[model samples]
Target chain A: MKAGHRHPADDDQDATTQLAGIATLARQLATAPPSVPDIASRARAWRRRQARKLAPAVVAAAAAAAVAVSAGVIPGSGGDSPAAVTAAPAPAPPMQTVRFLSSMASVAAAQSAPRPDVFWYERVADETGPATESWESTTQTGLLRAADPQQTSAIAPTAAVTYFAYEPLTFAQMRALPLDPAVLAARMRATLRASGRATGEHRTGSDQEMFESVRYMLGWGQATPELRAALYRMLATLPGVRVLGQGTDPHGRRGSVIVVALPLGGVRAMLVDPADGRLLAAGASPDDASPDDASPDDAASQAPAPAATPGGPGPWTPPADWTYRGPIHYNVIFEASGYVNAVGRRPE
Target chain B: MRTAEGFEPWYAAEFPRLVASLRIATGDAGLAEEAAAEACARAYAKWGRVRRMESPSGWVYVVALNEVRSALRRRRLERNHAGRLRAGHAPPPADPDDALWRAVRALPERMRLAVALRYVADLPEAEIATAMGVARGTVAATLHSARRQLARELAVLTIKETP
Candidate 1:
């Protein structure tokens, strides 16, 4: 670390370094910030208050030296979810994924809602948050028919970048087993039940059904750190798999532990038990596999993604250095496309 | 009151500059404007007193700066700090300051106040003291501590080259 106070170094050099840092800082401050009209109005409202004492200024000299560049506000969604701020999500447009909302109709909560009503999901601990789409409102998440099959899930926004204790299975271990989907499902069930969690019959979403007529199941339970730790160990035993970490479930299962793996194309995440090592929630990546293969769309029907803005940041690569920025908050993920549509500050 | 003539033109002339000031103060232009607006509102309400002041624009600047400080403090205090702390412990990407704000936001109320006022907002020690209601000496120390903590945590960040 530089000394806390350097003895009088030549003022010129010291001044120069400070100037450059300030200049660079000013350039960055110019990004287009969210245009929140309400916040603006509220601030203006404060003008009604009494005169408070004045404060000193950042040196005027510094302001000029600080800005090598200036900022301009622009229009268009960065589609940069809060996650994009924390970690640059790969450059892929948000897929229209709400179709999985119909899968919710089959969920017990959805099945119980009043007719003319949709699901009734809430933030498990902090119920004050937005109506959880997958578990609650159709407008928020589209419509999910609990009666439908298992859904194709992308990583839910709230669950991504989050960690939990997990039982991981290594690819080597899995290669030795039957490795069939039923066998995999049974292994998952036995593992979960042992960890004080339970799994429901796997269900499928319309998209998942169309994917390959594969039988996919979905379930939920509480996830704890201890459970996650166990999941980490167990998942390491599965062949062709590696557990990265864990995350919570969007459906509000605190006991649900998430696991990350590189099974096929890109890094895929799976929710598993830290205690018994059962898979709970899982998501696919277009990187590991082709987006074309993953999509249920008839190529002819899908629209091309919007073009990138000109002279904007690069074709959406990670910040040369991944700097965690914020719009840091919670996200609502669409199951069909795994695209995050909405976000709000973490509620009290 | 000075009938609004003394400063109306100046305030209008300084709008863009003031916007820049608030922008830096709040990290986001949108938030900065809100703070600046609040400060202006306060100025407007007290225009009689402000009109007599040496520099009415300075008065507005002070108010805006205070609003910036207060808003940031509130956000740090109210935000979910747990996830932030956990993320802070993780390795930072190449640009530490980009990620530094995240960890800074996760800090306890006082620490966050000290850090943002000093660095993110880049307010001077005297201004921070005035904004935070602390002694100038305390602002220096607070700034020192905040910098130390961030430097320690982001030791790995500065080393990574930009791709």
Candidate 2:
């Protein structure tokens, strides 16, 4: 070991012996390490895969950067202003993402607040199992039913309303949240700090977490049209958020994808319907695998195979023009959500 | 950017060690190979930058560990989702037939990673800390705790097996 880099077992003979024994066992397990092929060939293959996956992102980023340069908003260019006055230059937001989100905000704003209903119903499914249907009432009671017949239906107290960092909120508290994007962003930061869940100074992870929280509120919380609009606008201001072009949900619905690049190599992607601005699906994908390149075994183990539409079609496949990105780890699709009169009722 | 010439020798030397360490860290051999290959490919892609680091091997370790973590998180989420659908469903426990390996595998996730890096990768606490993205002190504490737990578990196993 290098000087000043002591092993934990160095001080104790027994610990050292134990670690050595463990090391020996580990070595025995690895006696025949998997054979490696030609390094150059492997590297070449990897480059090809990555190029195919990253081409769209590279083109989109280049276009956005070009637009920023033309607009005199060069990224990472520190101007002549005093250091105190001049904040670090932020990455230019992807122009296409900005446009799509701005449109989503407008669509959200044009809609009126939903009428008060006794129950809120949602049908959701993830790469886990069959779809789950839940009906929650304002009275803090709810019923949950799984599509699988073997699973027993559950009737329990509803989960508390929460928003932006899982900070519990009452209807009054949610209504009092600021509407301006900057102010709302500040409020969210404050909420994250106060919740005591924020750890480390990793800014990118915190931003990604905040984005997910806002998405959760938009999908399930009782956000009014006005609040939803503000939330969408706030998302546009977050650094590292970008457009991953178009993609399809598990249900075969086509939507525009906006992704937040995770600090570690991957992305948290949300797909939104272009016409209505409703969120269709959300998922995370590692940097290596393309979204549609998930192995059959992995898909079968994790996600329920897409069910055939009653009389419409079979499982959806990506078209030739589909943009390939990263491998999806887990995808949650929001099948439907609406106010309802009672338990077990779905939106028409 | 360092030319591909520099990457070939380093890749040949470090790849097997990385896979071995990752195999211990992740109980799944297949995941270890996949993560190691992926991390090496990434390193090769960014060889110019990675070669300038104090320890290129340390960088590869971090990337491979992150890959393993992402996969584990995905599996956990899927399991949780499956658990919800099938109420009371639980994932199977790690294999208990091999007491030593079982003890190592049974350690908390962070502790397991620390142990694997320290023993299998032969990394010092400082490098392990960097790879795990924790403070050096935290790495020492984690390894210390893991050692004690492993010793106790192995002792118990030995006693149980005594005729």
* TM-scores, chain A, per candidate: 0.20, 0.60
Lowest lDDT block of 10, candidate 2 chain A: A296-305
Candidates in order: C-alpha RMSD to true structure:
26.1, 14.3
TM-score for every candidate vs. truth?
A: 0.29, 0.49
Give the per-residue lDDT of model 1 (tens digit) for B94-139: 2226444444443444555555445444556766676656799987
- Range of the 10 consecutive residues with the lowest summed lDDT in candidate 1 chain A: A49-58
Q: Mind giving the per-residue lDDT tens digits that candidate 2 earns over A1-348?
A: 231244435534444576666666655554332233444455677677555434433443354344434434544455533331224344445666677778889988888787868766777777656766766566543333334335525321224454455444657778898999889987886665453322211121145555666766766677888988998898887655676767888888888787665432466677887676677887767552344333211221121112123221111122223333665543678889888876766778
Interface RMSD, candidates in the order listed = 13.6, 9.9
Candidate closest to the true structure, highest lDDT: 2
- lDDT scores for all predictions? 0.34, 0.61
- Which runs of model 1 end up more than 4 angstroms from their true locations? A1-24, A27-348, B6-29, B54-124, B149-155
Name the lDDT value of residue A140 in candidate 2.
47
Q: Judged by lDDT against the true structure, how good is candidate 1?
A: 0.34
Cα deviation at B99, candidate 1, in Å, is 7.6
**Quick one: best DockQ, which candidate?**
2
DockQ scores for all predicted structures: 0.05, 0.18
